[model samples]
Target: MSTKKHKVLVANRGEIAIRIIQACVSLGLDFVCVYTRADEASGHLALARSLGGPNAAYRVSSYHDANEILAVADHAGATAVHPGYGFFAEDFRFARRVAERERSLIFIGPSWRIIRSLGDKINTKRLARSLSIPTVPGSDRPVYDELEAEEIAETLFAFQAEQGISNSVVLVKASAGGGGMGIEEIYDIEQFKTVYRRIRNYAKRQFHDEGVLIEQRIFDFNHLEVQIVADRTGTGIVHFGTRNCTIQSTGRQKRVEIAPGFRPQEVDYAFDAEKLMEDIVGYSLAMAREVGYDNVGTWEWIVSPTGQPFLMEVNTRIQVENGVSAAISRVRGQGGVNIIAEQIRLGLGEPMGYDQSNITFDGVGIEYRIIAEDPANRFTPWVGRIDQFLAPTLPYASLHTHIPMDEPYEIPTEYDPNLALAIVWGKDLAEAKKRGVDYLDELTLSGADGTGTELKSNVRFLRDKTSTILQF
Candidate 1:
């Protein structure tokens, strides 16, 4: 276990790349950023060069090409690689490759064995059951074909009848899928038969795996997740609290709030706040220990209307909304722990710096994911050259984006449409939401004026109070 981090390569793009670069700088480690030709002019690459000097950036044919990234890492003598939340972040093979590389390049995430186990939804649920953690009732095995899906659906319906639950729906999900893709909601037997094949085909095409799992869909439930960090020694600490990710559209998160379940007055929820939090944290830590999970991860769950929490899945990488938890942790005076830095340290076999007692959650933090898409046109990607881009300088708000303000910026058509993330903290949720929307309003991104072709974003959507309101 060495504390020294010589050089690290960030194997992702967008704000997360910039985030890891900043963390590297904070830790006084040499940082390298790999980019596709499409991202040659990305703000993340520019920032990396600015922070790490001339030799900080490299270009690859594609970000998803692991061989090219590893070649560059070898060429640059990188000791570690950080897959920042997407692409190969959860790829067990990639993690194993990095670990077994001749140079001994460390992958800043959980062990490959743990990633392989938890990456499969079916295995994750099975492990949860083994640990006595509550899970949503669903198919016990992979639903490969229509017959298996039909059988599972029948079993689910029978169980629903036994439990006296009517109008229940089942979620057909890809066992190896992520980011809310390759999932279909089946309402009845007919729908199950129709969607089962489609979901398997989708899973095959998207994730390269045809394995699917069915879970009882809990409607009108709150999406909550706990952030936890673990070390090789089995020492772990869950974050100060939970994040409410219920504010979503089309199964994707639009906004996330920390301590979301703290407001017991506004929403009539049946769960005991103390016990629920304990369960979430307890289950997450216990699972991490079971798998020898080292580094940062998130445990996501759905809280039913009756206050029962069902384990959904585990994310073996940093989450998109982790900034809200970081903001809250900083306000609690815990020395503003940098999760990425901690991740690198943990990968280097360093022990966790803090424990549960040291972690604290204070105030409210909210994050709005600002995507460069036309909401009026069904969220179509608004790709163009940015003539001017300006973000607010609010004290309580932090903007994470790779959209450059200086010079012309071209929005690549090859990647996610997410342009930026605006995170704000306040004394309470109301103020956090208000300031978050205000900060979003202050942002401006447009094509050159008089071109009569301006790029549209979802700023207005973030300001909609009705959309921000939480539903139990």
Candidate 2:
């Protein structure tokens, strides 16, 4: 294949946009970036302008809807559309529109139909069960009333005949929700009824979708995940190792995230988690094969103390930690600089040499999502000009910092609070933790005293160390 330059239009904003622009530059492709009026002076737009020459950068006049973004892609004459990990990235309808709008405007992800299938919680649970994937015990469909929930519980009991679950604690989750919303635990059927009603009302008021899901709750578990990449050519699959995210202590207090969260807290039960990762990767590969999933995706799972890992959900596009995944993919020589590069190549009809021999380096990699939140006030989002900023340092490892050195960084109230990502690779888990700690300690954010540690207790470092110095 000739290495001809292709113009890529990123359909999102923020640090991820800059990351995609860099990837385009690395692969000798022109980048066309679009942003709202609010983001005209944002770091992402600034970086995009700096990367591409005149007439290559495109800025939209207004923020209408997903279709407006797609229209920008069409006007720019972009060969491919990358949704970047938020907004319409996982929206199946949006993907279908991109596919049908233009032949060359590849969606850069799994097909629209497959995305919609997995988009619904009910359908996803069914698919997981059929593939022998361990999913949280939940209602088969949306429960509209208390009696229907009871009936669903009876069916769940029948399904749980082999396992001993007498006092079942359930969680009411939304059928079409994510980002930690629409999930509440219930200790009794009455509580489940109440929580379900609350969730249903919230969903109706917010999403205009009154769908509710009930599932058994797993307590004191480690939030773990596995990432998988596949293609339509039936080339084998790739697993980008695993990550341990056990530091989400979101009760009434705030805490700093330490690697290994709590030493020996789950050491006696980690084997079960390893097995769960294997199963998750296997299930993801099977699902991809079943529906012809191409490009990159991830399967998330939660592991209990008993070593049982249950699939939580799946993300259909590049994730917040795409930097780490991209590094792994590149070290293995599987694709270009980023997952989008690989997706573009696959969409343009290129051969995928999915060889294990291509993947290199077996070190530990970890990412810390630096958000603009105040720990004292329940981790509320901090928005303003970043008057001062200093990135952390990494030793004995490769460091990838996403924040630009511009005098002012934009923090808007219309979106997520994740400001930047600090990805580091170390010789071992403990060493990786040390590097992470040292790196976090050097961050000097302005419009604030130092790093907000309210959510420090919820911060996970993925190491076995109990305590580490992180003085910023």
Candidate 3:
């Protein structure tokens, strides 16, 4: 067992695994990756070894089970495990098990305690309030039934000060949901009844939590968020700047995400874009210091029309835009990704080569998630193997995808179709958007080719029609 080279089990698939594997290589560490029955020939596995050294090992098996991954990590004598967002990335129980594994397999990212705390939207709201961060106006606890929700909403309407509501529509949301699941917009009791039942059933089936929360939804608002990183020693705290994701639809099934959305022509961010970025970074840093936050975390927020910034939620893992944001950080001379690596090093009590001041982000980068669903057909998700895949190459942009080249990419219906991420970076946001359009135009697939040519055509058509420039 070579103590000098850390052996890390990459308990994830897709572009994220490739990203982490690259980081491991940069640190001169040994790489280990696992795949499911469906992903035995995934690009993630191939890329992991292609970038790894001869000493590096790759395993293809059923890592579909959390316990299964743990057993493999234990048997492989892995020193640490990195869950690269998605799959079991935010699973608190999985994190706990990884930590409990013998031979000291450090679980990358925040402690299991923090994951659980942030996983529950109610608990996160309470914590945000305690820290003086304005969270979405909602009940401090979960709502049990329609009657309970109606009472809460009516009370809020009457008091007007309870949830800052002066007879306005509110969003009924599930405490445990991501990717826009278990949510509905309601105005009256009838609407509430219709939406709540559907949402409650979805929540119970998805998260086993029938309890939901009612929050004041911001309409026609520009969405802004800050990405923060905290070190284990509680010494280094940094923010990687802000991203505007305003382009959205009120649709329940599918919503469009435009990164670096056009500057709000009407309303500005709750805080000065630059100031809010720093403040959010500062607030999260202070909170992490108090609570001993470790690894990567993001303080999600939305800026209202009145320029009041409200904390929406906190994600205790590498967020969906992590790679894109990392590109931004590197261009700005900030160490977003480096900080995470340093935190991992410090948690292990190992000397790290992290110079917070020296790290820089080089260009504006945008990533568009290409899902395996038809955008025109109510965004119906297409499952099964992808028979063919033809990726695009943009100017100064590279594709980090899961679709295997020259082979059938077997995609299961069990998980989400993060088929590929079209990552494009430019000298600025404008160039990134142009590249994104071009990249979207060029992506191709077969049976499970992710939203197919028609999807790309619609996106491009809309981009041209809107003449509206946004980079994601």
Q: Model 1 segments beyond 4 Å from truth? A: 1-5, 236-240, 265-268, 330-332, 376-378, 448-453, 465-471
* Ranking 2 against 3 by lDDT, winner: 3
Expressed as tens digits, the lDDT of each residue in 1-472 for candidate 2 is: 3434567788778877777787778777776888877676667777776777556556676443766776777777777777877677788988888887645477777767877877666777788888888888777677767678766655554544446766566677766667666667665555655777788888788677877777777766666656666665646566665555554324211122222222232234345444555566677677767766666776767777766768777777776665555543444543334556666566545666655457553445566666666554556666655566677444443333334566655555676556666676555556666776676666666653245422221123322222331210
Worst 10 residues of 1 by lDDT: 260-269
The stretch of ten residues in a row with the least summed lDDT in candidate 3 is: 253-262
Give the per-residue lDDT of model 1 (tens digit) for 1-472. Answer: 3455478899999899998888888877887888888998898989988887778888889888989999999888888899989799999999999999777788889889888898766788899999999988988667677787788888887788788887878888887777777778877777876788888888888878888888787878878888877776755544546777877656554444555544554444466765776778788778887887777888899888777889988898888887878778752365365677777777777777667777776677778888777767766667777778789787888889898878888778888778788888877667776777677767877773235676777778767843445556
Give the TM-scores of the predictions, in the order they appear.
0.93, 0.83, 0.83
TM-score of 2: 0.83
Q: What clash count does candidate 2 reach?
A: 16
Model 3 stretches astray by more than 4 angstroms: 1-4, 48-64, 101-103, 156-167, 248-272, 331-363, 384-388, 392-395, 444-472
What is the Å distance of residue 352 in model 3 from its true position?
6.4
**111 Cα displacement, candidate 3 (Å):** 1.8
